[model samples]
Structure formats: structure tokens, C-alpha cells
Target chain A: MEPSDLAGMALIAVAGPEDALAFVSSGASSSAALEQEMNAVLNDSGVPRWPGLAAALLRWRPRLTDLAPERDLRVVERLGGQLLVPEDPEWPVALSELELNEPIALWVRGRALVIPEQKRCIALVGSRDSTSYGANVAMEMAATLVQRGFTIVSGGAYGIDAQAHRGAIGAATGRQFLPTLAIMAGGVDRFYPTGNEDLLRAVAENGAIVAEVPPGANPTRYRFLQRNRLIAALCEVTVVVEARWRSGALSTAHHADGLSRTVAAVPGSVYSANSAGCHRLLREGSAVCVTDAADVAELAGAPGTQLTPEQLGAPAVHDGLGVEDLMLLDALPLRSVTSVDKLTIVAGIGATAVLAGLGRLELLGLAERANSGWKRRC
Target chain B: MEPSDLAGMALIAVAGPEDALAFVSSGASSSAALEQEMNAVLNDSGVPRWPGLAAALLRWRPRLTDLAPERDLRVVERLGGQLLVPEDPEWPVALSELELNEPIALWVRGRALVIPEQKRCIALVGSRDSTSYGANVAMEMAATLVQRGFTIVSGGAYGIDAQAHRGAIGAATGRQFLPTLAIMAGGVDRFYPTGNEDLLRAVAENGAIVAEVPPGANPTRYRFLQRNRLIAALCEVTVVVEARWRSGALSTAHHADGLSRTVAAVPGSVYSANSAGCHRLLREGSAVCVTDAADVAELAGAPGTQLTPEQLGAPAVHDGLGVEDLMLLDALPLRSVTSVDKLTIVAGIGATAVLAGLGRLELLGLAERANSGWKRRC
Candidate 1:
């Protein structure tokens, strides 16, 4: 696209992501066409403007004359990044679920954002003040999911988010798919939290760092909230690893749930304040309880493709014993011997049944002959 | 009741609790009547014996001639205990939910087993090998529930069960209700695991220690499992505090679920094996996630009586702010100053809205005047 077209969309985008959608919905092809209609409305002359268009024009006109998208595009290009419009095939089709609230464009840095037709993207998010247990679970879950052919998405913030990104990048050795994607609230040109600069840069090298706003935009609080919708919209499942009783990650989870995507939460110590939000989610029936990667994969994978029953713990010695055997075993003396006749009376079985059960228990090494009768073996 | 009647019922009970029920169901008032019926069946005379009654009488016949109920009653009287039949008002009506499988009698050692008409009883059971986290939670939950006038029921074993008993006993000072009840697999006369003898004795003093079988009956493995059914049957809700991947407590929870009783499980660290059963319950949708005492009370209480929503954590600074105020607050810089005109453009609000929002933020101590413009307050 020419600099003029980039400037036209950027002018409308400067107001906010939603404003651009409104601009296009007005039947205006570009900012210039919208300006013509707005001017006509101002002079009380042309077809009536779309509802709320007049007020929106008032907000965007001030930004249109002052901003320079050519310079912003040049800045992103110099940083090896590209501006992605909704028309780009690289755009996540899942984001269409956002409907009218979808982002106008995505300013992406690093390798092209490739979400395949299978839509194997998952979002792992949590509190910035995560416990070591939460962080380890997040990292391990991310790595294992990546190994199983899923792309990880997260906010480029601290704690569980950073661990998730690191796990993805570290586990991407010799893998074919994009390792991870970090959706930033700030400009793609700058990683907001200085502490995670290296990790975010590594994320860009492996996959992409994306933002809805143009270059040099600050990561404002409102923008941070709006950014969550993007993460929720881009993924098929959102798993909250850990969160405080009140957290931004919860909002992200709610967003995913609102879009009818799968929402899963990892449960942690009931005593930990960091886990309270997760427990809250579980209590609300808003999220499935996830323990490990297989649980999440089952939630995100195609129907019936990954629906294997969870493996039970190692079997115990007496797991498969029959009813009479169990009854005879229960009646057997642990430290002293009891006669077979007494065992029959104690175990509520006949003498023949008791004798037969004792033979079975003896063969299984659960019972043994002691002195004149039977006793439980060590 | 006469000594002869006690002798007859005791003779039938020697075979098992079920045998007593079967004898009564056969229209035989006593063991002697049942013996006469069996003779008639053998001689091909009188009405055919009820379905399995012929086989059942064979199992009871040997024990009927050998046992003595009068002697058993004397031993219980010496121990200050009593034999409670289902016909007594003190019998828990909830056990009737077991239908055909209800225990025919309860040998109780403690304050009379008084499950009030309202049925304020809940079962808390878990693995004997419990973590400190599980123990603490179990104890706290028990104490709080006892204070709230609900009786706690648990298997008389170690770990989580003992802690629950202790919590209830300690918290029952000056309270009228029975603190806790221990449903034992063995006879109420003997607390099976000697390690918990002191605790069990205290429980009997405050609430009760009850068993289905007669005195001197060993707590066989089968009895332990059968004991779980009684626990589930005696309570309106069953909570598994912590359990292994395959635990007896889970069996109790499933039993409660099968009986249409509410089943709740406390959540814990995903990595802790002690919590695996609980997670499994949550995953299978068999149990609600319970954290604190209030949660258990709500589950056990009368519907709509204790339905208070959980209290949220302490409020944060940004809570309840309107959308425009949030936007304006987000536009304010941390260590830098910006004019109202720039704030209007960045926050995407009118200058008047920005000025009003700034004043509100200043009043809230979130923003303040900086030299020539506005910036965020510390």
C-alpha cells in the first residue's frame, strides 16, 4: 500500500481500534472519504452521516492532521516488522469471533504470524506476582504444549507470562511451527516492561510480538485491558496458570469464555493468595480444572481426537481381588494364626469358600501358612 | 425389650447386619421363628422362602446356635455403650437413603446418636497419609462447621480424619451440639488404629463413635470400605479434604454422590499427590470446589439460608472507576508531565472530560499537578 493509504487508516486508528471499525462501517472507503462525508454533514449538505459518525469525526479530525503514519510505518520497517491488516492471510481467522470489536490492523514484529487452518493456538496467562510453583507449572505446561504441536500466546509481562515465553522459545529446538507469540499492549517497536526485554526479544526471533496501536504508542491501562481481548480472540483456548483474587488474567479468561472458547484454570494451594483467582474460576464453573499439558490439549484439540481417559495411579497389590478373596483376606490375622474354620465364620463365607480363598491369597503372596493355620504375609 | 428378644436379635446379627434386616423382612419375629421357617422350607412345607432367604438362613444357622446377644449387651452396658436399632428416634434418618443396604443396627459409644430432624451433618474424609496443608484445612473446616451447629462425621482413622475430630472436639466448648462423630469400621468398643485411641475417646465423649458390627468385631478391610458407605449415608454432604489418585475417601465421595448427596472437594497444589483425587473429582464434575469453612457450611446448610457470596479480597485503587476516568488515568504519565490538550488526544476523550477526570483522579490521589501539567501520583 502507498503511504497515503497507510496514513488514512492510521488517522482513523489513532482515535482507537474501535474507531477504525466504525469508520469502515460508515460506507466510507478511507479516512479521506469519511472526511468528505463529515465536511458535508458539518455544512448541512450531503447524505446523512452514519449514527455516531459526527462525534467520531470530531475525535479523529484532531488526530488526522497531527499524526504521520508514513514515519510510523518506516519506523516499524526499519525494525524488521510489518503492518498487518485484517485482509492479510496471516491474520488469525479466530479473531473474527470478536465481530464488530475486532482490531482494525495488527502491527507485528519478527516472523510472520502463522496460525494454521487447524488453529492450534493457546493462550497461557496469569498474575505478574506468581509463586515459584505457579511459574514452574506455567513453564512446564507451555513447553509440553509446544512439544505437542501447539503455539503459545501470552502477554509480554512478568512472572508466568515471561516463563511461558521462555519455555516456548527454549523448547522450539528443531521444531517446525512458530514457538510463541507475545501480544503487547505497547508499540511493537518497544517491549514495555524493561525487565523482560531479553525474553520478549527472543520471543520475536522465534515467532512475533504484536500490538494493535502504531509505533511509539504507550501501554496505557485501558490499552492493556483492550489488549486482553486480542489474546482471547486469537486463541482457541485460554488457560490461566495462577492469579490473585483480582487480576487482569481473569478478565482475559472471561473474554475467552465470552467468545465461546475453552477456558481452563490450574488449581494451586488453597492457602496461596496467588491461587485464589484460579479457585474462584473453578467455583464459578467458568473454567475446567487443568493439571498438566494433556488436560489442556484435550480441551483445545479437535473433538474426540485427544479424549483419552486420564491414567490412574500405579495399581495396588489388592486392586483386582474378587469378593470372597477380599473378605477372606480381611479376616486373616496379621500377626497371629487363626484356624480355617474360624476364618470361615469371621469372613462370613463357608468352609470350602474360605479354604479356596486362602489358596488364592497364598498364591498371590498376600497370605501364608503359619504354624497350624493362615496369617497375612508381610 | 426382654432378654429372650435381645438373644434372638443378637443371634441373627451374628451373621451380619444384613441378616437381621432379612430376618425381619421374612415376617419372622425372632431367630427362633426364622429357624422354624427354615425347617418348613427344608421339609417342602408352608409358603416358599423369600427369594434368597433359604440361602441366607444357612449362613446364619451356624452363628445363631453359637452366639449370645445377652452377653454382648452386658459387655456394651459395662462399657457405658448401647445397641441402637433403626426403630429408635436417635438413628440417623439419612441412613435410610441406603434403602435395602441400610445397617440394621448401630453399636454406639458416646453421647446418644442424635441427628436432629434438620439433619445437620457433613462427612469429611481423606487419606491417612495427609500433608500438613490438607490436615490444617481439614481441622479449620471442622472447627468452623461445628461452630456453625453442624455435626462432622469422618472415618475413625489417622491423618485428615484425626485432625477433623480434634478440630471439632476443641471447638465444641460451651456448645450444645455433638462436636463430631467417628464412624468406625471396627466395633465402637475398640478404636482400631491405636494411634488415634485418645482422639477417638475424646470424640466419643463429645459426639459418638459408632459401628455397624457388634463388639469385638475386627475392622477388616471389607469393613473399612463398608464403613465408608455409612459415612456417606449418615451425612447430607461429603467433603474429601485431600486424597491420593485412588483413595478410600474418594470412594466415600462417590458413595455420597451415588446417594444423591452433595459432594465437595478441597483444591490444592496440582503437583501434590494428596490432591490428585480432589482434582479428579473436580474434573469429573463429581464435586464442588470448597476452600474455606463458609463454603462447606453453604454446601451443608438449608437451601437459601447460608447462600452468601464469597467475600472478595481487599479493594484495589482502580476499582469502580468509570470508563472515561480509567482512560484518562491511563493517559497520565508516571514520571513525566503532559498538557490537557495532549491528554485529550491520548485518552480519546474531550478536553472537558479530561479536565474533570483529572480532578477526580487528583481527589483520589492517583494523579496530581506536575510543574506545568499533569502526571500520575505515586
Candidate 2:
């Protein structure tokens, strides 16, 4: 790596991710230039200092002397992964939407191209304590989406996330492109939630495991929440399969909605607490209703995709008869025939109109003439 | 009855209900004048001929000679009920929204005040083959709405309609106003669905049984479809509890939508065939999601009615912490103390930030100082 790239990585721990971007964008050349500016502001002797510079300098000065970029690079290389700065050719341009909050570098454990274009990717996420209905729906949706040539993205946690990945990997047959990607809250070197170790290992073999934090870092609660933003930004659509009234999946949905991406939620029984959050999203109008893979495919706008028309039950016997004919048909007896004069009073219509309407009904095979008068055809 | 009113009753069977309304609205004065106009139009057209006039005259002539308005009134009176024309003071003004399609007369078997003001009425209707989940939800919603001082209206059918009436009747303790109204497709003299005879009788005792047709009329299929409009028109809001893909309940929802009334549908499992129609309405954006009574009450806009705030689970321990403090808290060990120097690296922040954040965390009872270091509190 170049000296400037190394300096950017070292600055990540000193000034924090957001402020580090602010310092780099302020026309500094390298760590040497940044050090000189910090020294100048500390002595109160030289160039004008920006607001919050003093407080930031206090935080940066202590960490600045201890940053070891070379050792950080060596550790990742030893794990058979590589550090990817924004200048690298494989960096995702979609991260640019995050602007100043974007990660300084990515630690990748598998194929770099696993993160496909936004339109070709979707994130399926939900509660970690999901019911079997939610798990089945998530798995089915993921498998169908994979079969349609789209990659699935998730957090690599339990429940809906694990099911989504399993469905994608299970359906990936004879396909050259990877079927799934996992965005980790900690390091890609070792997956958190040790119960998912084997599943994530299989994930790395078939697709990719990525993280913003350095190797050996723990997945903290704050990092888990921040990780959700990456999953939201990496895909064109985010679907919440099932969530409780208050769940982490809702945060992911809100982030996707904030980015103006398509958000969808599956409907469940009103009696199920696990589906309350999904219904809340539907009620708030923040997410459209998504039932199956066809609904999701249409929302993703795949090439030549349209909503599959709803399957209708068999048509009723008198489906297309008009109002007057329907009334006449309703008045006709099934076992016996009655005179037209009596029918006029029973149906509450004119006799001439009843005769004409009966003729039309007979042509449609809905009415028949008996030996004496008219009766309904069964 | 007045001469003009009796003439209107006889005219109902000659022309269809809507055309009878049109003829009466055309300033014909009485049945005698209507006969003169029909005679004039039949023989080479003495007066201006309306479109469909000759056909209407042909139907009207045969029924005119046998008209028996007094016998029809006597039949209803013998059944301990009364016929209500549009000119009656007890007629609902809300039906005016139906305009020319309004019923010419209503056969009522209970209190005249059963069909309350539109603002105080709501319809809860669904499929005749509803699941237990839908039945329970309908019952609960109807009872709660009744307790909130609202009347429930529905088709006098089997499944959802029967349950709604039962719930409302069960909750109507010492209430002066009727709790429910049944709009039937047949004569009010006898309930159509024989299986629901006792339930329909109970509905009549507590509220009313109403229909457009006179005594001895069968509940024909066409009349059943048309009865949905009356339920839709009688209420300010229509809520579908559960329905199949092609259920007649959806027709009522569409009618309510056409009248610009509030429409709501309860959500259920996608696997359930009974909920498919409700989901279709929600997916098509024709109905809002309704889970409980508060949602329906808010939609009904009762006086001083507002939606109850959502019930939330217990707050998390780290809820109020900022991003930096949250990062520090995550970095702190649960079972052991760690120095600020170590935390600075683990949290990816400066030493000054780590020390200052720990002070704030300690004050909030989240961090504790132990043996010259800090650790997370239980």
C-alpha cells in the first residue's frame, strides 16, 4: 500500500471514522501534514482552528503516537484476507451514499465481487426469535430470489438471517456468481454468535464475509446497529419477514426507507405478536405488502417482471349475467316451473323485460323452459 | 297509508325499485297519473317517451290491474312489523348517498331506531366460512366497539355476521340504544338461513331485522349481493374481518370505498385462504390495516376518540447513551475491569474520549470504577 493509504488507515482509530473523513477532506496530504496541523492548533500560535478541533486534538494526540498501520495490514494478510481502501478497484460505489459516515476500509474474507450491483441484491432480515412461519417464509423468499439471478444480503445472525443464507446456498447450483453475502458487526476473521460458525464458514466458501472493523474486534451492541446501515446500503430492496412490536429489523427497514429503497413486510395473523411490527409498517405506509417471491421480484423490478396475476377460484355459474337477468334467474324455481305472470310479481320487474331477460339467460345456459313454464337450470 | 304512499308501494312491483323511484320523482302525482302516462306512451306515443318507456309500460300494465297495497300492509302488520317508505320519518338519511339505487321501502321487524346515525354505526362483515381466528377477532372488535357506544351492522349470514351480533348483544348491558342491526336479503318476517334462526331471533329482540322486500320473499342470490350495499351505506366505516379471494365481503368493501367511507381490513397469515381477500384489499390500497378496536374507533372518529398509544416493551439499559458512550460501554468487559488505555484501542477512539465517556457512563449507573480501572455494571 502507498504511504497515503497507510496514513488514512492509521487515522481511522485516532480521529474516529467521521472526523477522520473531515480531516482528510480538509486538503491534508499525509499523517505528517496532519501532525503539523495538530501541533499548530495546540500551541495557539499559527493557522485558524475549526470548531471542535481542540476537543478532537485532545482525543487524537494520545492515539496518534500508537497507530501501527503496518501491523494492522500484516494481521489481515495472515488471515488470508485483504484490506480494501476506497481507492481499491473492488470498492463498492454504493457506499458513497453514506458520505462522511462510510467506512475507511473493508476487511474481506472471500471473493471481492460477491457484493453485486444494488439492483441485483436484496436483504431479507427479521427477528432473531422468529416463529417457524417467518423462518419458512424467509427461506422460501431467499431461494426463489436466488433462482431468479439475484444475490441475498443479511447480517449473518440467527433466525431469519441464517435461514436466508441457507436457502440461498442450497439453491446455488451450477451458477458461477455467488448467491449470498454476510455483513458482520465485528471481524470477518471469526464470525460472532458462535452457534452460527459452521453456517458462516459455508457462507465464506460460497460467497463472502465482510466487516468494517479490524480483525480481533468484538461485535458490540453499537456495532450491531451500525452494521445494519451497511446491509441497507448494499442492496436495492430490504424485506422484513416478521418482527415483534419493537425489533432491530425495524431499524433496518427505517434505514432502507430513509435511503428511498423499496421496503416490504409480510403479513401474518393479527393474533401473532411476532407479526405486530410488520403490521405496524404496513399501517404506517412505510412498507408495501409482500407475500411471496413473485411479490418481491416485482418490487425489485427484475427485467421483464410483473406481478403474477392472482389465482381466482372457479367462476360462479351465473358469473357474467347482468342485473335484470340475475334477478330473473334468482326468481326461477329449481324443481318446478311457474307462469311469467307470477314471475313478474316475484322478481318485481316488467313482464316484457322478464321475457327478454329470460331469453338472454337461456342462451347463457343459466335458465331453461320446463314442460309448462320456466325453471332455473341447476 | 296515504293514497300517494300506497300508489308508490304498488309501483314498486311494476317497475324495478330504482325505476319506481324514478317514476315517482318525475312528478307523476299518483298511480292513476302513472297509468295515464303509460297508456299515452303505449298507443303510438301521445306524450314524450322516455328511453325504455314502452318496455316499462308493458310490464306495468299487467301488474297494475291486480295491485293490492292494503293486503301487503296487512301481511306485514300481522307479523308484528311495519313497512317503512322513504317518506317515513324513521328512514335513514344515510341511504341518500345511494341516490337512485335506494330501496323504495324497507320491511322492519324491530325498533325503528335500530339503524342509528351514520356516525354511530360501523359494519363488520366477512366470509360465511371464516376461521376461528377471524371469528374471535370479529367478536372482540364488535364487543369493544359496542362498549365504546357504537352500533354494529352486518348481513344476517352465518359465520362472521353471527359472531359480530353475538358479541354486540353480549356486551349490550342496560344500554338504551340497540347494539346491532341485521340487514337481510329476504323478508324481515322470517330469517333466511335456517341454521341461524335462533341467533337471528335474538338479534331481532336486541336490535332489528330489516329488509327491502315485503313478507314471504325468498333470500335470492341477486338480493344477497344487493344487500351488501345497504350494510355499506348504513355505516361510516366498513371493516372486513376475514374473507376468501372471491368472497362477497369484498363487494361491500368496494361499495364503501365508492361512497368515500373509511374501509379497514384485519391482517392474517398469508397461508390462510380466509384472509386472502382482506390482504388483497390492503395490497390494493383500498383498506387500511386494523388490528384492534382502538384502530377502528379512531377510524370511525368518535367524539373525543384518539388512538391509544402503542404499548412498548421494557426500555433497554443502553437506550439513552450517545454513540461514543455506547462504543465505550460495548468495549468495557462484563466480568473484569479494563484500563482506559486498552479501551481506547478496543473502541477505536482517543484516550481523552474514553476517559471522559467513562465518567458520564459511571454517573448513569452503567459503569463502575474498580481497582484503578473500569468495567460494565450488571
Report per-candidate DockQ: 0.36, 0.39
TM-score of each: 0.85, 0.85
Q: What share of the true interface contacts does each candidate keep?
A: 0.47, 0.56
lDDT per residue for candidate 2 within A1-378, as digits (tens), equals 111122333455456656885664454434556555444433342324333444444444444445566777787777667888787778888887765456777888765434688888889999999899999999999999999998899999999999999999898887777789999988787877899999998888888888887776678888789788888888888999999888999999998997788898899988778898999999888888878877788888976665344546777887988766877888888888988898786665678778998899888887889887998887
* Model 1 local distance difference test score: 0.79
Residue-level lDDT tens digits of model 2 in B242-301: 998899999999989988988999999888889989988988889999888887888888
The top-ranked prediction according to DockQ is 2
lDDT (tens digit, per residue) of candidate 1 on A42-161: 344223433344444434444544477899999999989988887787776777777545677788887655544336888999999999999999999999889888889999899999
Write down the RMSD of all candidates, one decimal each. Answer: 7.1, 6.8
> lDDT for model 2, on a 0 to 1 scale?
0.79
Off by over 4 Å in 2: A1-51, A59-84, A303-310, B1-51, B59-67, B78-80, B303-310, B349-356
